[model samples]
Target: MRIALLSYSTKPRGGVVHTLALAEALAALGEDVTVWTLGRGGDEGFFRAVDPAVHLRIVPFPDGPQNEGVGPRIIRSIAVLRDAFDPVAAKYDIVHAQDCISANAVLPSGRCIRTVHHLDQFTTPELAACHERAIVEPDAHVCVSRSVADELARGWGIKAEVIPNGVAYERFADTDPAARRAWKQRLGHYILTVGGIEPRKGSLDLLEAYALLRTKHPDPALVIAGGETLFDYRDYRARWEARAQELGVQPIVLGPVPDDDLPPLVAAADAFAFPSVKEGFGLAAMEALAAGTPLVVRDLPVLREVFADAARFAATPATLAEQLSAALTAADPRRQTAGRRLAAQHTWTEAARRHLDFYRRAGQR
Candidate 1:
């Protein structure tokens, strides 16, 4: 089977990671897979992370900066659609689009599948229209989580199949003890949070929770690994830094660690905390689990679906802090065992096979 995975921008975001994982998984399963993405900076990096057998075709779109205003973004998305769908668009048996916002508008007119990542702040009226068109036109639709599928049914009256994202099993298998020690020596004893420092991600709430945690545990540092804020959410990074200073917490903001360094960083961290209020799927939490690290996650429905009985759930900042404290102090053998077992159940190979099955079924329809 030949597949064309369509995504507007394949940056270092979770959606991009999902697309790459599925593509590589399909390729590994003896399917001819080609990733069609908006030409972005981390294209080479993303491909390097995938299996070497997988093929990549980047379609560069003449779009404004990613942080541009809504008007320019819409115009740029239109331009992208025109360019991306003009040539060689109908060559594949399946065109799987990631994210319901942009890729939904530009897929070719055959067996197309749009994967809804989430429906939080990025869901605008234009995005809704694009998703509606895709739902009516495509042969099948997928959602990363049940919460997102339910939201699609409620908001746009479109039903979608649920397919959870998978993680690369080998990437987190067990770090070298020497390398782990070296990373600890370099970064110190720190609590790690990996994601963009934006408002919707609950970075401010994390800072508030971290401040409270610092009152009890002052020695461990807080290391936030992600890119600069790209949303219009009032510069939460600045506020976090100011609040951390006022509270006398040692906070280190490492803006987006390289892909090669992520595994070691995850292994070196004492614990992982993800206080996201909204997420279609919690990939970071999965990464932490894969690394045999314990996790404290927000009590969001999607997260609950992903973690199941593997993670400690907290609904608010205070509860989050309490959970973090417990996670820090106690030896959670059950959580560690459960996390490793759950991580083992989700593999890129299995995910890719399921995707190929879906594509073949969609093509028949």
Candidate 2:
């Protein structure tokens, strides 16, 4: 079957990563798959190289006005993508959208599938409308975790297919020793978190936790990486800076690291912290596990459902500090082994087969 997977941007966000990975896996299963995304900031390709078998259609979405607000930007984004995609929408056997904006862009066709990675409560009028329409209008839905699918059922009486994310286990598990040494040499012992400093990422909470961790153990510094996003969080960022200063903590914020360097950086970390307020799946935390690194994440239902006993859970900053501290010092070979085993089992091939099964069932309907 011919499939077109749509995502809003070519950035390193979770949904975009899922789109690319699933496309390649589907192609490997002898299906015709084409990945469609906006070439934001003139990005001609994805963050990492994709399999040559999958086709790509990077619709050039140039930046909007200098003073454009998030609402206007989102509206313009939908218009541009719709203009580029709607004309060709009829040819594909399946058009699956990965986010609200892409789902909205394909809304006119009334024949698209959606992957609701997670549900968010948006207050902005336009964004709230987009989010609601994206959820209600799709012909079918897929979610990365059972908790999220449960939310859809409770909120809208919608049932969705549950397809867990597949991790690139060997990419991180078999990272170059020299590359790991280089990150260790540069950053020393550090508690690393990906997805940058944002409200959803719980950046301020992590800062507070880091400060608390420093009171006893000052050996591990806080290193944050990967913050490329479409939303403007300058106000939140300013507040975070003030909190960091007030707590007497200075973290190394490496904005966006290269794709090739991510594995070694994760491998060299003392421990990985994922204190996000919301998440479909902790992809970065899973990568850390693939590298045999201890992980501490927020005590959310989705995380608990996905991670179980393979990771340490913390509900607040104080507990995050406590869990992070233990992760730094304590050595649980059983937990480490469990984490590696979990990461190894979630392969893209299995995810692809399940997706194909879902697609075929949908086609029959």
Q: Write the per-residue lDDT of candidate 2 for residues 120-221, one digit (tens) a residue.
A: 988778888999999999989999999999999999999999999999999999999999999999999999999999989999999999999998899898
Q: For candidate 2, what is the total of clashing residue pairs?
A: 0
| Per-residue alpha-carbon lDDT of candidate 1 for residues 1-365, written as tens digits (9 for 90 to 100) | 77778666656678778888888778777888887666644333452356767777665554367567754565466566546664766777777777553455455454568887877544556645665565566667888888889988888788888888898656876777787888799888888999867766788788888888878877678888876322354556678777778877767878777777888898889889998888988888898998988799999888988899999999888988899889889988998989988988888777777777777776777
- The local distance difference test score of model 1 is 0.76
Compared with the true structure, the alpha-carbon lDDT of candidate 2 equals: 0.93
lDDT of each model, Cα atoms only?
0.76, 0.93
- Count of steric clashes across candidates, in order: 0, 0
